[model samples]
Target: MGNTQIGHTDFMSKVRLTDRYVASVSPPPGGRIEIFDDNPLGAGLILRVSQTGRKSWVVRYRNEDGEQRRFSLGLYPDVSLAEARKRCIQARLAASDGVDPAGAKRRRISERRSRIIKTFNDLSLVYFAASECGEWKPRGKRKRPSTISGEKWLWTKHIKPSLGALPLEDVTPLDIKNLLRGLVDKGQDTSANRVRAQIRQMFNYAILEAEVATANPVARVPMMGEETPRDRVLRDEEIRLVWRALGDPGSLTSAQGARRANQRVYVSRPVALAIKLLLLTLQRRHEVAGMLRTELDLDQAIWAIPGSRTKNGRTTFVPLSPGAVVLIREAIRLADAGRDHPSAFVFPARWDRDKALTPASLTRALRDVSKALFLPSLTPHDLRRTAASHMASERLGISPLVIGRILNHTSEKGGAAAVTLSTYALHDFMPEKRSALIRWDKLLSEIVSTRL
Candidate 1:
């Protein structure tokens, strides 16, 4: 090993490169210099020192074609002398095997960059943005806001904590199975299924659109459990119990008529009115929870729900019964009383005046009430089912078609009937929906007023 001068201003020193020697070397005053490693393990490793005091490790090698090439190992301090030697040895071996190490490094970096979504969290952000921008709509229909909101809630509460940080390619079917298993163990079987479906769709999107994931891990994973269609129609006594619990906190007592001292449940007046409206109108929980002031016409007794908010992506005009109108007005009054300025939502969140009462909050409220009343587990959606069930009873004999219209259910029939109903039928069914709701209101009034 000897010293050699390449140019007038630059020189090369042949030295045994070590941590101590590399750290002791100083930069040249005018130009850069390369210190070649004399140690056998260093191979073609050299430490480049620039006039600005920057030091980096570079490995010089010859390709299969005998062309000279220089590949950077890394910067000094960040990449130690021993590590640089190790990388220098590997690079020299790769060059000896006729592979261009620099090109290979570039390809690896390019592939990583092509995988724009690195983690599940990154995939979720891109997926949600694409869905919002109409990139992933099925049959040219955008996802409903409530559906998106629910999915976001699920992601934040359940999915994100478990899988958000996991690399997209590393999420195995077993990971998804274990995630679903955890939910199932917590008695969230339906939620587990929903989470499974969401994960499946996300991975499908990753494969189809992002091109980052080669396969869907959730494709092989089965549903957590068999989800039976819920038919728990509330009996009249149960309905009365729910009504009393919503209206009177004192009525929320155990089956033995004893109020749990530690678990006194209180329903806010606006939430109570919203729950009452849910039963009276037979609308979805999110629909009732997100009732907007602009959607309601108290004079015309109509609630025109826009397509953006409805589950079926159709604007529905719900004919409000007198009872429904009364509930809405009461909720509005309470909302106004609680806020300095009028809120756009009929049922504004207790903490945030600008935002509507979330469907999750409604669910929680019903959960508390159910626990206090010692009632079988009841969701707010169950209230809608109770009304629809009662309307279709033998006593009322309300036509299923009318009930369907009142519920704003999409026509599920096929062929000419479906074609006519979906394509040709311009009838809003307002009159029929109104009549059915009025009859339901009358029946509900009786059920609530009757002493059990």
Candidate 2:
């Protein structure tokens, strides 16, 4: 074989050897012929450097079965001298143990990185109800589904749309930043914050249960926490206006206003009485809405609400004041007048006589009242806030707990809702909360009595 020199002599790359080994370049390229001991049959290893500069090691040995075994230690100096030796050792050990060294190496590499990338698209396919460019968001039950529905919308509309395409592993800090920045740019601050919260929950699920290694993408997302608190309560004068607007036979807005303006606001006689009961007893809108006519004992001045209708998932009873008794009796009288439809509710729906007006109906009625002011943009929750504020300001020494109890609101300090209808027992916190309500009614009465 003719010899050809590689670039530099100092590197000792060009081979000069005798014919038994023939350590010449294989071609014009950098082929390494066998580098061996002086004799080809020596007991050491041989290295062959290829034209591509890859060097592999081969050892010639005799197996215990008296067969010849030759092992290739793999291409290198990329593999390194130490790594080649390690591979040789592993190959020798595997051959001795009757394991295929090549197969073992492949298995080790496959086990280390066996996971495939999981995109949000995969998780969403199982969870999502719609496919507006691949998201896992559920559809709205209706045009409106109580206040919780709005929270759900915030999660689906903003957060799910933004980061719902990235693979769980690819969702880095920068990805989260970009998503939130895009939301802020669109002036959806409140919605952006809500989306951030929901995304954080998704990432948390991904980490703990889904076995994805990404940290919560929204862990560091900033919030423009409330800088201005919008007032939702009806002021003293506005309370008077709401009462004045009640009972006024004009538009539904006017009629609803008159009813909501004061506590005794309702069009249907039974519904009117229910409102009166809500005011006198300070019972929640649902407790009064869901009351079966049978649950009321007018003679005993008591109303029993079953646990199924209660928010706290418990049975509670409420003592009816004289005012409460008067209201329910009036409702019964009106409901009795509809004897042709015995199944008719106390506040029967105009569209469906079998169903009682929903608890939401009262709030909707108040919104109608606000619409009389050509839509002042007040919400029904504002009315509840008004009730609380009025109790705090005017009711005689009423505790915040009493307000919570009457409203069936869960106590902020504790998990208990003070006045839920879970118990079949007749006596409950109604006496205390009712007393507070009656006091509130008197204040409202005083304002409305002036006809201002």
Candidate 3:
């Protein structure tokens, strides 16, 4: 027991606080009761209990200005006796050094809140907006519509639903690892890699450009697996099968025959011709699918792909072969005959005439035709590879550089030849490219004519 000091007529009780003793004390009748912990008699802590049985731990000390201050430690049982005593000792040390622990704690809390990014979903939008406006540095160009659409697809499908509501700062590498593992577990390695790339880009923008986060949590996450490049070039026999299947549907079985028979709805006249043109011209699937009527000059046998539509952003003038010219003319004839077809696109969508046919639609038609022929499933890209492969072979006698130019491959070599081509030889290499493609087209024609 210790001598008690009355607080302006309110009764004050003093007792030694132990784990068992603190729990037994109750509040007195009228006002709140203050029971002192008598361990450090003079400058000790107080347990204040209200009439409603609410209990709180508080420390009484002198601050830097020598002013008596009573600081609330915390509620008891939630904060045990040992923890309260330890904190009180720390507060006493801070006061001796003329430091205000209460003010410091408040500033720390305020700083933490100011730096908080509430959620990933919210931060992702901010980052995407910054990217679109060219506000993020080292990224001077605004995202194209196609690029933006792709990112939105990834975000909507994978990112938003899972980690959208979680606090950005609280997203650890383990959280990212777990999310990616779930994607890989489903045998979607390519999709998992894409998700990882999207998340890494967003976090990088937040850390480096937006300055919202101190570190990028996605920096060290390994890719799910290495991707094997597709090398599916159609052989001579396969090419013959495709030609026969598209032209003669009666040669296939009942199931495959049904797919080819319902060509009006799924496989339109222009889309079927688009596949033949892809095999003849060996252009990109999108370029062939979204061909505009104005870009073609059938009189000169040229199909010009503008810089905006090309992957490399270069104006590519494809010299159409005799075989290609025949396909395009037929496509134009069919499109002109259809009253519902839009004049802007060579291959307009069947339902929506205003919009050009999507590459996916053209690809679906090609897959159906391939399936009908009972050939290995091949994409429009494989046709391009097939053409390029034949053109580059020694039998064709075409130079590798001319083949590369025909394919419009970006030059990665840092050498004199690359420098000379980029700086001096600004020509489209039309003469060499035309020669190589003509030889390739001839070979394809012989295969289709002889084998079928």
Q: Choose the strongest candidate by lDDT.
A: 1
Off by over 4 Å in 2: 1-151, 160-190, 210-213, 225-231, 243-377, 392-401, 408-428, 449-452
lDDT of each: 0.84, 0.55, 0.75
Which portions of model 1 show Cα errors greater than 4 Å?
Answer: 1-116, 250-261, 338-340, 413-428, 450-452
State every prediction's TM-score relative to the real structure.
0.70, 0.46, 0.62
lDDT of 3: 0.75
- Provide C-alpha RMSD values for all models, in order: 18.5, 24.5, 22.8
> Which candidate order results from sorting by TM-score in descending order?
1, 3, 2
lDDT of 2 by residue, 1-452 (tens): 33334542112322323333333334224334455423323333455655555556665555556566676665544554445455656666666777655545545644432243267645443322222322322331212122234444555676557656877667676776677677677776655566666567555545543444446766766664232455867666776555555445143434234444534323554544555455456566766665777677778666666666666644556666555566666666666675665543556655676766677666556566556644465654565667677778744668886677666665455234323433321345667766776677677667667421
- Model 2 compared with the native: what TM-score? 0.46
Q: Where does candidate 1 clash, by residue pair? A: none
lDDT of 1 by residue, 65-86 (tens): 9989899999989999999999
